[model samples]
Target chain A: MVIKRKVAVVGAGMTLFRRRMLETGKELCFEAASMALESAGISMRDVDAVVLGSAPDAFDGVHMKGEYLLDGAGGVGKPYTRVFVGGGTGVFAPIAGWWHVASGLFDTCLVVCEEKMSSLHPHPQYAFWGIFDHTLERPLGVNLLWIFALEMRRYMHVYGISEEEIAHVAVKNKRNALDHPCAQLAAKITVEDVMRSEPIVWPIKRLDSSPPSDGAAAVVLASEDTARRICKEPVWIDGVGWSIDSAYWTDRELAYPAYLAEAARMAYRMAGIEEPRREIDVAEVYDPFSYKELHHLEGLGLADKGKAAEMTVAGVTARDGDMPVNPSGGLLGVGNPIAAAGMMKVCEVFWQLSGNAGKRQVKKDVRTGLAQAWGDLMQFSSVIIMRS
Target chain B: MKEGVVKKGQDIGVGRGIEPNPVGSKYAGIEVKESDLRDGRYMSIRYSAMFRYRWDTGIAVGRFLEGLRDGRIVGSRCNVCKRILVPPRVFCELDFAQIDDWVYVYDTGRVNTYSISYIDKQARRMSSPVIVAVVELDGASQGMGIMHLLGEVRPEDVYVGMRVKAVWRSREERKGAITDIVYFKPL
Candidate 1:
């Protein structure tokens, strides 16, 4: 028990995840922020502060991006701030907002995250090349997929897992996305189709990955008293934790994410959840690739090491499974807009816990749920727990 | 604080969500639609540039580069952890101590993991695929793989734990870069 005020996510809003949209990054933030304020039954005037999140200056093709997106994020004339942790910024933005309200500094906080990956030429993936070690790894002509592919192969080799077994996650998530209104690449794909799909890198295929997207997401947070007054049901962020490993990614075993496990341990301790496999009702994890969902699940302690892929094989992570994950289609199906996609995970938890996710609702009666996002050379993990 | 002139949209109404207005209605009376932008009613344009950087490859990386230029693979060994770090650095990230010594590692190593890349770094499809592997050098440590291209082997034949050795360019061709080593060939 910390002596901080409790914080609740009163409302959330998001634009459809798509390959490209007419809206610029700021415009996207405005639409999502406005919708979120409306959902909370309030206008921007009622908010005391604002927090924003987006990944990379290269993707948006601008510098000083925090202030660039300020007015559209409803941050003008308020205590505005920005938080960035690459892909982890999605969940991390709300976590920042959580502390803003919890610290008694602001009664209401607006959190917005946006990414316009289409603005980058060649492709969004090209912007990722800049993140590697400029002196060492970059000179080798490396790309983002190479690292993910390397990690996936190591994980498979260590645990004796197969690509075919991992393809099941693609099948499950795409089918799950068919029910999501904002999904970009939702389809009835099969493991066979995944096996036959074109490979970008041998282990990572076209269907196995999330599409590059341009989108934005927003949420409104308020103190306990304010939430009770403004919302009929406010989803409580019971716990939050984040951890980042060394930048020397190659030094550690690529098969597992010790960073995420450490973060999950801290969050579970704060929430008083000892048996995560049984206690957590549902989850929405970062899944830019299908193998990533399994990797993150094990990291979250919801499944044992080497068991996440087996659970996917058993259909245990389905919408109706004992502990469902990614009920809103996840990044693989919805779209990978980086920071916005991470924020979308927070939105999914809010929607699921409040019974507001219309067609993509998990069969489980979810009173407690978790959302997580990983970023930066497989080194960072952020977690947020919510209860209805 | 002013940007562009805004025109009224025909779809404005109570509870109709004015967010669809592309030019913004922040001033209460200002709004514009997608059609107005098409008709050149508002002024907005795209801008781009090619930015470059000249980063100083300090201490650790500098030594690593020097070693590569001399046709040798070097690693830093920490006395406290007793682990050798390839692509050598000056200090151990886990322990806050400076490394005790620079150790020479065998160029031969086993592939930890690899990928057959059909696309270039820019996400453009390549005419021919490149084979990239994370090779854990024999003396550096397990899981500490230096990422490099693989050559003289079929893509299907490249597997985890497969033995490989560096295929270097001629000494005259050395450029003090990771490309100094052309590719790793199967031993």
Candidate 2:
């Protein structure tokens, strides 16, 4: 083992995820940061550094999104860094905070992620067009869903999976979301409902996808000594890992996410979790699309390849199941605001490990949990393991 | 630091800070319906990114475009990996070596995967669905695909591994761009 300094998430908070929020991006950051500080029983004076995570600057129509969101993130004068890994930024921001504490450079760090996708005109989805390659992919006039659909198709063809099997994820996640106060698309829909929904791209229905939302999530990370002094029970970030693959997404195999697997391996190795399925009590895998939840679970080594869907179908991934996943309703039900969605997973895991997750809490005692997020043209993954 | 505001150090509380009685009980954030924006109830400013510049296509892509203008799909081959990178690159990401050998790939290819896109890049509904496919061009490394539009085929008719050929515009209409090859049609 590396025998590094311990770091823990002392407090966590988030605003409601919605299609459009009246609060400006800065206000949203402030509100979430305030709630997190209050939860930790601390004030701005206690924070030694600040880290902000947000998606594309174009989404907010701002040139410098990090600097623009500085004051609200409690980073006005403190040592600050803005981290972005597309949607993976949520966990990545906290990981940056972990470095601040773990590096013994700061006693306490505040990590905040905010995304106001509604600011972009002609729908927030339009902002993603810039993510594709300008020379080859952009000239084809591509939509984001088209690529996801292509990936989903490849996964299905390889595994002999059916759309019905994937629809079950949407059904389960939406139902689980009903208990979440911050959820935007909570419902009691069935697989048939998902199958009948409007198809944005073939193999991907409207119900199978998360909504474009404007929201923010935050967490306060503290050094072990500071955590012991301030919080009664802190969720320790036992492991943190992130990896990014090639930008030539077309050349890679869409059937599996090799980058996410590499990231998960890195996290598991640090956490000393050789058997993720047995050791991990709960997980919040990214579910931007219904199939992605299964895809990520497989990538995280929480389930066997081509078997995550079976776990969902068999109730092994339910709220009360053996290895509960997405007890926060995930991005599919809760709403995805790019970077904030990943941060929301980190917050959910913190709450889960600390026994703070209320109705959405898993049935069994959860001592260890993981939050993983994928982003940037299906090429990036960030994982954080938390233990109480 | 605001004008006329009392400094915390000069306050009567001194070392003991005043108690904060936070008021609102609800979670943070105020939700607004889309109608509010249309009605102008909540103020908003319409802004667009004003700055724009042309990207230099660079050495590898510059030649690739030249090849397309001449009715050919050019790729660069890495001697170390022996892999022909489509939509050519000056360097091989895997081998970490510069690639100078330019290979002309067959215009025909097989569809690796595809989608019937009912929405455009702006998420706007299109009158007719645009069929998009990742075509792995022949003579290039296996799985070395480039994203392009699929045409002259129905959405239901498209399948993985479907052989297709590029439908290029006439010589006069040719421009040194990806659009010169309009779409790929089933052979």
Candidate 3:
């Protein structure tokens, strides 16, 4: 809100999203961080600070994970910090990097987000059980899908929607992933395939969800003057916003994500975006589940309430369609490594805006783009708008 | 030959580098099978850590749990906002004022939302599905609900706005926990 130096995304890189990788979490961080530095044409000597984002130490099977990932994140001898807001940390981490540069404290910041869900024994979904109220909800034995399915069902019931319609988001995103080099679940499937897939929950089929993955993503954010000197075309961080709702998630309606809308409003207001549906050329929203892409689209006001599904069914969210969403295949198409998934969205937006997204680039001429993430039992949301 | 002659460029390490995939050829990573990992073929270390929490439920939750043990549903009233919260809290998060009093709410309410879960906390498949629901207590304010189980009905039969009542355990068998009420059954 006050006067400060500007920040620009000069480089971004990501490792392959997979179910299990030979490299450990710290090793994955090094891979992505080094690639990001190479892409920016700057070495670690140019980066003055490091900010890492990852979700659930339980998944990594480690504690004080920020400190653990420091060396691999290229923070061996620099101002280092770790930001965690559940799954929102990926995009939120960059907002932290932006702060370090915007505050004039650091000229260049290397932001890294990684998640090795493979460390979660049995399955990564089990780690989410700890997220519940240890006393109240845990004794009832609830899994993550229960809440997501309940919300999906409620959204369908309230709007008279159907599972068949929601399946189309998965269809679009997975197909879009066919063009993504980092995608883990990229496949060409029909809505019928989605409908026929094994049911995890009544409304959520197996194919409708993103796979738990091991991966890492990194980005280099530099101050305006540094960006001008290092790169010819730097993607400016136009505005950033984040918000959290009451932790009493069950006490609120599941049909809409009010927190995300609040976050979007904060970001749009800061970016001076009066009409998001028109002004923002593209968006890379968090879509761990297929319905979520549609849900966030509505929350971002890119589509009206209960209209996102209709728009998706009409091919309005396709790469070639108007206001394309998840052009990098989203989390559903790409794998979900929690924090890395959100960071990948930021990279996707940066790529889309810079005209560097090869096969997944949108047909529309992109200028201003928005990226958002939601997590922590639907409590926290991080939104960022960028321009080239 | 009495002595062995070594080559100049000796290669001993396994050449299992990153795999080649036409789908995403540019991205780099390594992969292994589950078989190799399960039988100690892959050198690794494993251990377990135990954590037990003695959480203090504090004022509102302590009273709320006490109410559950008494076979009653209770909510706290924020005097300023006058909103009755079912899963009660001490201070009004919005008003930042202490809640005035605890009020008893009906055990019967409509199912605000429900889900049929087939997996347990460990992500293991259950033999039969469990119906979980968010019951909006009758006397509680709109959308103020708690996560609980639903019973005595099929998953397809469960719907939003379906009237339901809590099936509580015997008073003598009750503990001051949420499980005091087994599950909610449709009316």
Candidate maximizing TM-score: 3
lDDT of 3 at B27: 59
Position B50, candidate 2: lDDT:
71
Instruction: Compute the lDDT of residue B143 as modeled in candidate 3.
Output: 90
TM-score of each: 0.92, 0.95, 0.96
Every candidate's CA RMSD? 4.5, 4.7, 2.9
Model 3: lDDT equals: 0.89
In model 3, pairs of residues that clash are none
At residue B171, candidate 1 shows an lDDT of 96
In angstroms and one decimal each, the interface RMSD of every candidate reads 5.6, 1.1, 1.2
Per-residue lDDT of model 2, residues A158-186, tens digit only:
78788998988888888889988888999
The residue-level lDDT of candidate 3 at A69 comes to: 87
User: Candidate 1 at residue B77, lDDT?
Assistant: 88
User: What is the TM-score (0 to 1) of chain A in model 1?
Assistant: 0.99
Say what the interface RMSD of candidate 3 is.
1.2
Which is the better candidate, 2 or 3, if ranked by DockQ? 3
Model 1, C-alpha of B88: deviation from truth (Å): 1.4
